[model samples]
Target chain A: MSTSTTLEEPKTGTWDGGNEPLKASYGKLMMWFFLLSDAFTFAAFLIVYGLSRHSHLPYTGSPEEFQFSTEWWPIPEKVFNAFPGFHGVDLPLAFVALMTMILILSSVTMVLAVEAGHRMDKNDVQKWLLWTILFGGTFLGCQAWEWTHFIVGTEEGMLLADGTRIFGANMTMNQYGPPLFANLFFFITGFHGFHVTVGWILLVIAFISTVNGVYHKRGHYEMVEKIGLYWHFVDLVWVFVFTFFYLI
Target chain B: MAAHSDHSNEFQQTGEIPKAQTKVIWKTFFILVALTAVEFLFAFTMDAGTLRNAIFIILTVFKAFYIVAEFMHLKHETKALIWSIILPMALVMWLMVALISEGSYYFDSIRNYFN
Candidate 1:
């Protein structure tokens, strides 16, 4: 029966439906597939994070005793409260919130650029793309500042009653409750930041192509739309990271 | 009337312009901003517990879908394409739940035995 089924004639052309059953362009569909795989990678990282956090030694007891039990995780707000130019002020989550806003704004500009591309307005496309690049660059700069601030070590830092001082952050040690917490923070946010950098490069190329009238000659600006899909995917990933890493 | 006809021909030369979607894009932007504000509010006000975490996850998923729908134009795509992307994500969710729960269970048992 299996051999008989194998001998059946192949369905070609209309009989097989179109090559792209979803009707998506090759580039767009490939971008979706890439995003799907990347999503799984992030999901694994986060699941490991949850597992590790559930097993970490949590800070407890008073300053005199300073007990550690496998029952607590570092509170994100207490760790990420510092903001640029504010220095001593206790502004919990302010800096990261600003970073989130900047990223969201960049996503808006990316969509605007794609929309302008649809109009075949080269000037508008260039303008919006430039704005998107600027916003993305600002977000990158903010991340750099945040990373530096984290590595510099606060004045108080984390002091134990036994006079053990934990300062700065690394794979093996962090002032945060557990080293695993810092490990996950660097890996997840660093991965997301790398995506933002890739989006920046893609936008710059799309901008240059727009200015050179390449898309204009093509009679469509689907290139801008394709890159826009990537930029928005970066933003979508940030939404999950923000909630999981920073908030919850 | 002649100028209007010329404009229509110009549109024909180019693909259909999505000028109408500008309003929708801005609306999504504001909605996202509002959601971020709500998240920050919860982060500051709500206690760290299951309820707060659940709310954050729900809100984050809402933001993710809104961005995919409006910004990526996934919502306007064919049902097959949407399902192709969404259905696979369900497996990711399953993996997350399975791994986290199992890991936590093991940790709980190990901690109890050691204590």
Candidate 2:
């Protein structure tokens, strides 16, 4: 049998001219994708934390005979109650609020740096980038102090029945109601801190590059914009972490 | 090449000094600060319960939206890009819902079985 040969016109799919559908640079688009994926990672951690908190056995007995019961979970306000230099004071969430402001201010400085980059004003870009770095470093210092306070377990930590002092935070145990609670705290906050540190290094690099007139040579300050995205994403993740881990 | 030189000249003329963005940036900073302050206030005042937690989640989402829109320039980007990020996030939310419900069931079973 002879088959009828039909030459059909090929249908064209979506047109992508290698142009950014978002009008963003390839770098920025990729940065956004990375951040979105990072967000899911953070979400998984926080959701598990919430689930653990929901199922945790709260400490109901006295300090000396501290025991975990399924009845209650340790209050976040009670756990994170200590403040810097106020050794005996229970300033719940005050220092953390300050930390939040520091991150916000750093984000502001980062945007200012990007704004200066847009103007191609190298001096302002360098100045603002340096300020952003300073703020990030300060925030990191505060986090270090917080971790030290948490690990030292001066007043908040409790002794368990097995004679294991739930001092500081590790993967195994915590003075907090449940080991999972502190584990999530350390992991989530540490992950976020790592991001902040990376962003700070990137900022420093961007500062040097700006000083060296790299973007000036490239005819645009898009590198600054890209780094700003990363920095702001760090701050953005911290917002969620603060809400779930500290505020809630 | 003449084309390469023209491209550089065009880029030079396009990006003018953006003073307006600085003002917008400061405004966003203050809004974030104020929202954080409000969160702290609520944390201190409101009783630790579901309602307070819901409000915190709402406020956090709002802050996240503002940061992404203004700082990340998502507001100026195309709808396709915005939805690409947001729609995938909805899937994350679904995962959260599914996993959290599963966790609740597990907790109930453990509590009922052991206690």
Candidate 3:
């Protein structure tokens, strides 16, 4: 699945051969299968998230008068209110909304690049892939910044089950409502961030290949389409992540 | 026409985007943006409840489907390929519902056992 299909199609043959089974090339069919398994992995993670979320009581306190309780899940809007430029502003969902927009935009560029590849237009592929890589990189950078703030903890801090004041999040403890809440945040978003980083590297390599006429030499640009599939899945996963972690 | 743009010969390399296709792509982008904005509006204005959670999950699923169908070209693929991917996801979604519904029971049992 990592490499592109190098064999040219058997132009107009009686048997479609093993290569074109199910009306898709071997590479594409394999990519879809891989994506299905990946989807299962994510679904399992998120289902666990949902379970952990419902096990705890809801945070009944007002966001303005927010206080963490060991028995309730953290109110996300209360916990994730810190925006980049503004201090002490009650701007919940602002930064995450921006992150989601950036990722969705990158997915668009990736689709454009794939569209260009289908046309065998090398220059357009290069251009759109450049934009996709830029957006992906920016998203990774934003995630890094968000993680930094999350680790450093809020200024007011949170009360633990022990009645001790703690700052940022760690494995066993956090200022957030449940240690599980913060733990899931790290695992889910960190896992997605790792995907974005890998996809960005792949996009850069794909960009370089577009520039060097690698696909042109091979007489097809199916590689871009394959990578586009991966890139879009990354974007799709983030949509779920943003919904689960930030919004609700 | 979109078909011509899709199958333009190797000699036609002006780096021009397919106009109709670009329109569709931008339209999808705006739809996603609008959906996110609505989620934001709800986040700020409405208090969180089962209703809000349902709306968010439904909207998120819609966005996810749109991306897979359009961006990943799953809609363009054959029906066999499509169902093979979606059916299992449907089952997984069912599992999600089943497990989450049992969560309160799990919590109760664990609390009882511990106490």
Interface RMSD of each: 3.3, 2.8, 3.0
Residue pairs of candidate 3 with colliding backbone atoms: none
Ten contiguous residues minimizing lDDT sum, candidate 3 chain A: A13-22
> How well does each candidate reproduce the native contacts, as fnat?
0.66, 0.66, 0.68
Which residues of candidate 3, in runs, are more than 4 Å off? A1-21, A160-164, B1-20, B111-115
Clashing pairs in 2: A58-A72
Q: Please write out the lDDT profile of model 1 over residues A1-248, one tens digit for every residue.
A: 45555477667763386476778888889988998898888888888887786665444434334423213577777788898888778788899999999999999999988888877877789999999999999999999998888777577777766887767788877776677787888899899899999999999999998887788778889999999998999999888888888887
Give the lDDT of residue A26 in candidate 2: 83
lDDT of 1 at A15: 32
lDDT of 1 by residue, B1-115 (tens): 5555432334344454445358899999999999899988888777678899999999898899889999999999989889989999998888888877787787788778957
Q: What is the interface RMSD of candidate 3, in Å?
A: 3.0
What is candidate 1's CA lDDT for residue A4? 50
lDDT of 3 by residue, B1-115 (tens): 5656533255444665444257778888888888988888887788778899889988998898789888887898888789999999889978888988888788888778857
RMSD of each: 6.4, 5.6, 8.6
Clashing pairs in 1: none
Candidate ranking (lDDT, best to worst): 3, 1, 2
TM-scores for the candidates: 0.87, 0.86, 0.88
**Chain A: TM-score in each model:** 0.87, 0.86, 0.89
